[model samples]
Target: MNYKQIVQYGVLIFGAIILIGLVLKGNISHEKFDSEKWKNWTETESELSLRWDMMNSLRNNHELIGKTRTEIIELLGKPDSETKMDFRYYLGMSKHGINTGSLTIKFNENRIVTDFSVWQG
Candidate 1:
């Protein structure tokens, strides 16, 4: 093959590698929400088994935006941390392996969930 053809093939290969890496890093698992598994996860297991998959399902399948704080706790168990207006559930490490993740649910004066977010640190 000519030099130009060889360079083109090299670029294509590199692009494919990058695409695959991105797909894997994104943690494309779509596991359904399992309360048992979620509540059972300990800190040590949390680092190795990320929960983004189940988190995705929990966010999508559950209508938590308007639920009361008590209702959320009934569904998701106790929070790892909490304040007067919010509850934060430790969701384990991120798939990227660099940051820990948590789900923060914010409540309003009436103790109802106003908004929720998934965050990493």
Candidate 2:
């Protein structure tokens, strides 16, 4: 190819790489746990707001409760840890020196989520 054509192709390839990186970043950033939200959240805040966020999180992830292992992985990616009968995800958010909390999800032998708990640390 001519020098100019080669330059054009290089720019296009670079742009594609950058775009793919951004898309992957976006997916990772929108995890089942949102630490920044928790960091800013104070126990003293309105109960309504806290409940809202909690409910939203559950709503978004409730589908995993009954999904097969393969299905959950397709949607939420691989868990931090896994076993024959359970899966665990340790995740959370932090910002401005304040951390919201880490959330841990538990799944049952059926490969469906059974419960979740949170810890502020």
Candidate 3:
């Protein structure tokens, strides 16, 4: 057509392209932000390390179980004696309160606890 008509069409086409680009960018960023937030949430859940220091609490009092020999020594200060059986090692629990129980740990080799049982007296 004429130069003016051609120029007007060109401007209209350029504006339409810019509008489409902005809409596409906004949609892409919205999706990306949502995915990033979801990734952060999942990673945060998996990064938790919860340790139960039951033996530490037990040592301060009179009875604790499932602790390594070092932990027992640190907590109870000392032990009266140590005994070994065919299946496991025994850490005796003395009476500190109403609950009196013994901690038994079954070992496979050396002194590793493979299984455990608690006997309350």
Candidate 4:
């Protein structure tokens, strides 16, 4: 074929490959959360943790709105850092790969979880 036709075909193929890659990445990022896997994922390197894969499931299935501090620790293990009002657990690399992500659980005066959020820094 002519040079113009060859170039057009190349561009189409490249675009299709990119679209497929995006679809696969999206699917991989939403893996179901498993408590056993989560507790055992103790990789020091944030990027290696299974927590990234399970994040969506944890947020959707687990109810952290009113759990006690003891319950939180029992479920999620010890936090990387904690304060009087909150605990932070490092999840893994952010979607952008420029920073790490963490789960922050907030508690009230009764030491019950009031809210929680996931963030990337």
RMSD to the true structure for each prediction, in A, is 4.5, 13.0, 22.8, 6.1
Query: Which RMSD does model 3 reach against the true structure?
Result: 22.8
lDDT of 2 by residue, 1-96 (tens): 899999999999999999999876623333244434433444453422342345346456565456677765654456567767655544343321
Q: Which 10 consecutive residues of model 3 have the lowest summed lDDT?
A: 43-52
Task: Rank by lDDT, highest first.
Answer: 4, 1, 2, 3
Error of 1 at 78 (Å): 0.6
- Which regions of candidate 2 deviate over 4 angstroms? 1-58
lDDT of each: 0.83, 0.54, 0.40, 0.84
Candidate 3 local lDDT, 27-69, one digit each (tens): 2221121222222322122322111113333324433344555
Error of 3 at 70 (Å): 43
**Alpha-carbon TM-score of each model against the true structure:** 0.74, 0.39, 0.26, 0.70
Candidate 1 — which pairs collide?
A: none
Model 3's lDDT to the true fold?
A: 0.40
**Compared with the true structure, what per-residue lDDT tens digits does model 1 show for residues 8-102?**
99999999999998887667667888877776667675335446668878887899999998898888888999999999998776767677788
| Candidate 4 local lDDT, 60-107, one digit each (tens) | 898999999999988888888999999998887655655668999999
User: How much is 89 displaced in model 4, in angstroms?
Assistant: 0.2
Badly placed stretches (over 4 Å) of model 1 are 1-26, 45-47
Clashing pairs in 4: none
